[model samples]
Target chain A: MYEAYWRGMGDRCSLVISGSEVMSYLGGNPGGACWFLEPELEKSIRRIHHLVGNAAAQAEDGGHVVVGTGSTQLLQAALYALCPPDQPEPTSVVCAAPYYSCYKEIAELLQSKLYKWEGDAHNFNKDGPFIEIVTSPNNPDGLIREPVVNRPNGKLIYDLAYYWPHHTPITHKADYDIMLFTFSKCTGHAGSRIGWAIVKDKEVAAKMTKFMEVTTIGVSRESQLRAAKLLGIICDDCQAFSTNTKSQNFFDDSKRLLTERWDKLHEVVKRSETFSLAKFPKDYCLFSDRFYETHPAFAWLISNNKVKDCASLLRGHKILTRSGNRFGADATYVRVSMLGREEEFNLFLERLSTIKIGICNGIAHIN
Target chain B: MYEAYWRGMGDRCSLVISGSEVMSYLGGNPGGACWFLEPELEKSIRRIHHLVGNAAAQAEDGGHVVVGTGSTQLLQAALYALCPPDQPEPTSVVCAAPYYSCYKEIAELLQSKLYKWEGDAHNFNKDGPFIEIVTSPNNPDGLIREPVVNRPNGKLIYDLAYYWPHHTPITHKADYDIMLFTFSKCTGHAGSRIGWAIVKDKEVAAKMTKFMEVTTIGVSRESQLRAAKLLGIICDDCQAFSTNTKSQNFFDDSKRLLTERWDKLHEVVKRSETFSLAKFPKDYCLFSDRFYETHPAFAWLISNNKVKDCASLLRGHKILTRSGNRFGADATYVRVSMLGREEEFNLFLERLSTIKIGICNGIAHIN
Candidate 1:
């Protein structure tokens, strides 16, 4: 989906690195909170975030940017930082229902003594200190959400992976204690495996940095330098074309592509009897300076009773999707990725439109 | 020390990447055991290892290569793979005394329930299942080591970070069940944060790959590709100059530089009364085709009883060193890095030659 956009942009975003540059283990900012984080990359992240008005990255707030291999590592780092090591019992980690599928798996992967996955936040009944992961413009459901568990001792990790203006409206600048953003969703450079956390508290940031050092010894400097270059290009384009609505900036271009895909998906869903798409209301985006509907990276599709398993039904048509059960939702729902190549997405829409409720009953047997 | 070698190589090892290349989350080998492992990088690693005669990476052995963010992550992955999740007790993970300091720190960082750090493999008397990490040409005290605990349930992870021909002689091709290597030590590309595991069992390889996916999604593609390019250059140099000793190859060039530094340090140690260096016997190196003494990246310096704290004593002289206490040894020893730039290495030798045993007692007070 984003390949064409980057290709059309030509060498303006390309990178050339010398063999001897950035070869040492320590990064440029050795004395900062994240000793291994490249200073230029940190500056680029703050500039982009401030330009987008998504998160508070100003130096006055004492926000420290801790870079990770990806947001996945950042998620684990956050859990490790928030949970007290000497606590008698493991800290309960909870997220809302229909949350990202990886939260539980990542939390329990190492079976850390400091924290344990306690399932959905709505069902969390414990009164002790807890950590709630709030994914705004959430993964499976594609809905903006806030923390469901309200407690004085509760901590929050806001995974704003999909909070960019192209995916969701620039809903007021998210002022949170900890916020995570990734280069994957923002610039469609998932292979770089670069993500950063904008943490407000100095101690928490230091602990997070320690987690990075103990885990992978810090994120890749090659990726950090490359990400800095890419983010600089994005910021440069935004500055040059801030008032030009017709110019194809990164956000505007991505939004245009996503809107077209969403429009096609809406048409397909309206005609289908076996599946229904989640509806999102129009919201004003400060970056684009207009009201727009969220054309999310994922489509939350609910299947009718005729289809016993939405994921299995889609599999019959050769369309791969994640089952809602993985996200703590009923199996009647399936999350379809809307970020595929154009031809592949067209094939998915074509296959999905042909999947009628009558055929849903015996689709598995026929396939 | 290795920086000058790489800088001398110039743009032959430099990398130019287009914006559209390697943008997808998936790698070229999506169906591989390590799905996110780049195919070219895997091929390059196998080629380099085969060329160096260090590890068994041949395709005929059905060996699988699992790439990680670095060898640090791979060590954790090896633990996760060797220790069964359903075990009644946490598997004891031990390395020999004077082991890599990070082995203990990384193992216990998460307080993992699957494995616990059981210090000093020589003292590990438990008869149950255990994971032993064997660091040949070890970090602090450079020496070849093998597992001391002989048991049927014991699993071994060979940390060959310093096994390159530049650091130690290649005695034979290692045919271990699991072997860990990193690009940081191989080419002094520490900022790349790339490492890999060669495993004989497919199940173990798959489990290690799963750990990588759950932890970091995968290592950075930019780093992986850059590593592949750098390794390719080394392999090409070896091929082009295999018969000529006069021509500069990667290993020969690095070994020459390391030999000079070691010679200077030996002269200083011979004259200093307060410090003694570790002894290493000359062994036949197949790659260099000569008998060569080990020139480890770190110097294990033992201080006399006059110095109470070796690390503190060095700190007073403006030298940063890790105390032997961190490596589970007495405080009379300190690990000094010999991999600094040429000027830094000279300054260290100059300062060490001026220090006498009489000053050790009053060093803390004078500083």
Candidate 2:
């Protein structure tokens, strides 16, 4: 999705790492809570968040930046940090309905005695203590969400991966205790596998660092240095430009790209009687200084009553999509990624627009 | 330790990554057993192992290469893959006494229900199912080791990190079910945090890959590419030279450096009344086709009874060494690193040579 923009930047975004640079596990961030986080990367993370106003000021909020392999590692680290090891039973981990599916898988992968995935937050009632993952501009359905089960004992891990201005409106600075952000979603460098958590509490931050240490012995220093350089480029561009200028600023250009994609997707969905999409209200984006509807990374496509399994239906048509059932929803819906290459996305739109649902012996069949 | 060697190589070993080269991950290794394990890296890994004659031939043995964040994560993955999740009790995980302390911590860190750390394989009795870690040319003691607990149900994870020719002789091609290696110890690229496990079973490899996916998504693409490049250089050097060549081949230069350090260390230990070093018998290395004494990355320094806490004694002398007790050994033994920079190693040797044990009011003290 973001490869073109980066490719266009060319040598300016290129990273040249010397043979001897960052050959030790310990990075240059001597004062950082996370020992392995590079100081330059930390600075870039804080600056980006400050510029976007999606997260509270790092210094004022006492936030410590902890880098991980990706938000995937950070999520697990957060679970490890928040949940006490000596707990009598595994603490119930719940997320709202239609949440990111991997939450359940990641939480339960180790069969960790510290925590257990108990499914949807709406169904979570018998919790002495729990963890609610709030993925605003949620994975399958792109709706701005708040904690469904807000309780004093319920710790929250706010996955702000899709909270960027291009994806959705940055309504206000989030002052959450724990927030996870990834370079993958932020800049489409998923291959880099760089993610970080902005944590408020010192002890939690230390514990997260310990988790990183014990797990992978800390992230790759090469990745850290590269992320720092790339992020620095983005921040530098934003600083140089005051208003929305095509190709001048990263966020502006990305927003323009996403908006165009969303418009095309809306047109396809409108013309096709077989599918429907959620209608988002126009919200004022503080970062962009304008009103815009949410242009999520994924489109939650709802099939008409004739189709029972939307994902299988699309699969038959040679279009790949994740079934909504994976996100604890009915299989009638499928989550189509809006963040593929332009040509791929266009082909998917073309395929989706031409699909016809016909009744064959009282059973709906794709023609 | 190896920084100087890499630094001297200059641009020949340097890596230049363009912005869009490996952005989406799903690396160039589409046919690899591990989805994200880059093709170039897998080839290099197999080639190195083949060149060194450490692990069995990858193709002939049906071995699948699983890249990890480091051997740290790979160890956990091996444990995850070997242990059955549905087992009534956590599978006993044991290593020999004076094992790497991290094995105990990492195994029990998550309080995982699948496996539990049962210290010292020698002490491991009444085990129905168990996983034994055999760190040949072992961490603290630098002696070639095999699985202590030999049983039908006992699975083995061979940590051959120090099994390289420089550290120890490759007496035979290791044909273990699961063999672990690291770039850190192999090429002295510890900061890269890249490690790989060569497994005979496809199921085990798939499970390990799944563990990587759920945990940190996968290893960094940049690090993989860098390791591939570094390994390629090392292989190319070896292929170009038939015999030992100074500064021309990686292993030859490294072994030369380690030999010199060990010689100096042996002299210091021989002269000092407070300390004694292990005497390893000369063994024929197939790669070099010569008999050479072990010159490990670490020195297992055994102190005289008068200096009970050798690590503390060294700390007082301004030398940092891991406490022997940390490796489940007595306080009289401290593991001193021979892998530090030349200046630091010299300072340590100078301080170590001058150290004297004194009795102050019947209690032993370092003077």
Candidate 3:
């Protein structure tokens, strides 16, 4: 689990990655060490300012940009800035169920109540007095929904953390008051800790900037430069990689591998006949039917009677899976990351088959 | 100035520097993303348990470590946590003159009153009812003073931003209620945005942590790893470089170069008779002497009204220097960074000589 978390989020382009480029821009000066000033630092700042404009131009509304230590920091900054302590704190934050789990907790930590709108596969009810946190292609589920209503007076902070490649560009919806995005997700560099917010309203952006200044002062210069560098690199890569025939062929190969694993897991669950499918949204890319079978709570059901939770069964076979409870769901559900090689998935299948035979024959006790 | 800031603060091993390291360690993740969980993030809660132990070890009284985007954010967090909105705010923060300038601005931004205890080179008065901000070997003008007496029940937040290499360690002193330090200075990485506080009281630390959790969540994980990596490298460098005779020789050569510039500047100031020595105790470093001629205020004086008020004259030469007013001192003064190379200093002196010659002949104007 630790390895997965680290590998999934920890692969980042270190600041040293662009040292040569930075040095070239710096006129061979190793760094701005002699004085408390550097021309390259100024140049980097100007570059960021330009990028901000570029990002703003791409947004639905051309709003002011305020940067933060990361999008996570900016999220907290937005809440603190918008939600005044003097007022009765908003009754609760309205978030889609299976949303980014942090939104509810952050709101609760701020003493704000949370209201979950359990949006299943087909529906989203938009009416709510509370601030709405809308994530496109939401985490865990990875399904995109464009809410029909435009809530003007109602505060809305959109988490566009995963909206880059997979989801449609709905930033032009003209309803989002604040939008958040991080470099970690888009560029496969999670560690630089750079994120920015695009607020349609100037007054809102100003408050957030002030809040950020007081909070983290500013994002790290090193991270900002590296972010700018990686952003340029990734944008180029995205354009090139998307068009390459080989890349498309590779995608097909990967999908085939994933489908096979999904089918095998489906067969296993069907054969066991001990569990029934709760709900499987076809629109969701990840979180397939296999996710339901191996959940800890369901595993608990089987474990008490010679059955094992999917995560534990997978884990017993050296496969790591995230406990569903971590995502504000029942422990009976476990999330198996769909990110693995075909061989790895086959290995996971082999382990599940072994566990199933043992449990059915009363050779292995669930407990 | 930006270059100087980096040269003074940037780490050698890691390109990124910031105060995010505190959260990375405490929250067990690099970025403060856990703070945004819809449900409480389990890792954050689990990490906090271990952080409490670490904090206990670091603090005089058992305390908790609340993570912030940076020490600056923590500063604001401390303000939010301590100052009640219900009561009339405290009249002002009584910071030592020539202190870190951010103290007054942060207080004012919070709408608190601000007062200055203008300390001359010889002595600083120790009496005050206001929150006191103390900096040892302070910025621009480095000065360290031993604490005389504790003001019973009064608040003191020490800025130890530069208290790493040049200043003596005083973390052992249990008198301070809160102390702030950043990885930027010690580890030479300001981009990671990691800073920490040692609060003598557990309640104070807890309050601060809550504010941080609400405001910034936690620092970045990628930054933390980079910092941890850089810190190891810095420690290794310190050990390796300190023992190397060649490194000592390099410093000796650099000091000789600096001494020549200082002597030339002293001679020019003596001949001009426009500026006089700023008094200091016998134990003060040679860098203090640069203030007379190289300081922005002094240069400003020479360039304005045939050497009139130091602030205006310095501006005329296209030289950027911080006015003393920013640091709660008389407008006649300005702080200049003495971190330039010998050639840079020589060029500055040449400009000064020309300005002096122009001023004496009434050819220079304050405009």
Q: DockQ for the candidate 1 complex?
A: 0.85
Candidate 1 lDDT tens digits, B1-367 = 7788888889988878888888988988988889999998999999999999988898886789999999999999999999898888999999999889999999899898999999999898987999999999898888988888878899999999999999999999988999999999999999999999999999999999999999988889999999999999999889889766566688988888898999989888988767888779999998778998999999999986447698887887888899999998988889999999888988998888877656644663332
In the range B278-327, model 3's lDDT, one tens digit per residue, is 42233322321221211211221222233435655666775566776676
What is the C-alpha lDDT profile of model 1 across A1-367, one tens digit per residue? Answer: 8888889888988878888888998987988999999998999999998899998987876788999999999999999999999998899999999889999899989888999999989999997889999999899777999899988789999999999988999978888999999999999999999999999998999999999998899889989988999888889888888766565688888989999999999899888766788789999988778998888899999875546588987898899999988998888889999999999999999999888665544563322
Best by DockQ: 2
As a TM-score, model 1 comes out at 0.98
lDDT of 3 at A169: 26
* Candidate 1 off by > 4 Å: A243-246, A359-367, B244-246, B359-367
lDDT string for model 2 (B189-293, tens) is 999999999999999999999999988888999999999999998998888776544438788889999999999989988887778887999999988899998
DockQ for each model = 0.85, 0.86, 0.17
Docking class of 1: high
In candidate 2 chain B, where is summed lDDT lowest over 10 consecutive residues?
B240-249
Give lDDT: candidate 3, residue B17. 28
Candidate 1 clashes: the total is: 0
lDDT (0 to 1) per candidate: 0.89, 0.89, 0.47
Cα miss at A158, model 1 (Å)? 0.4
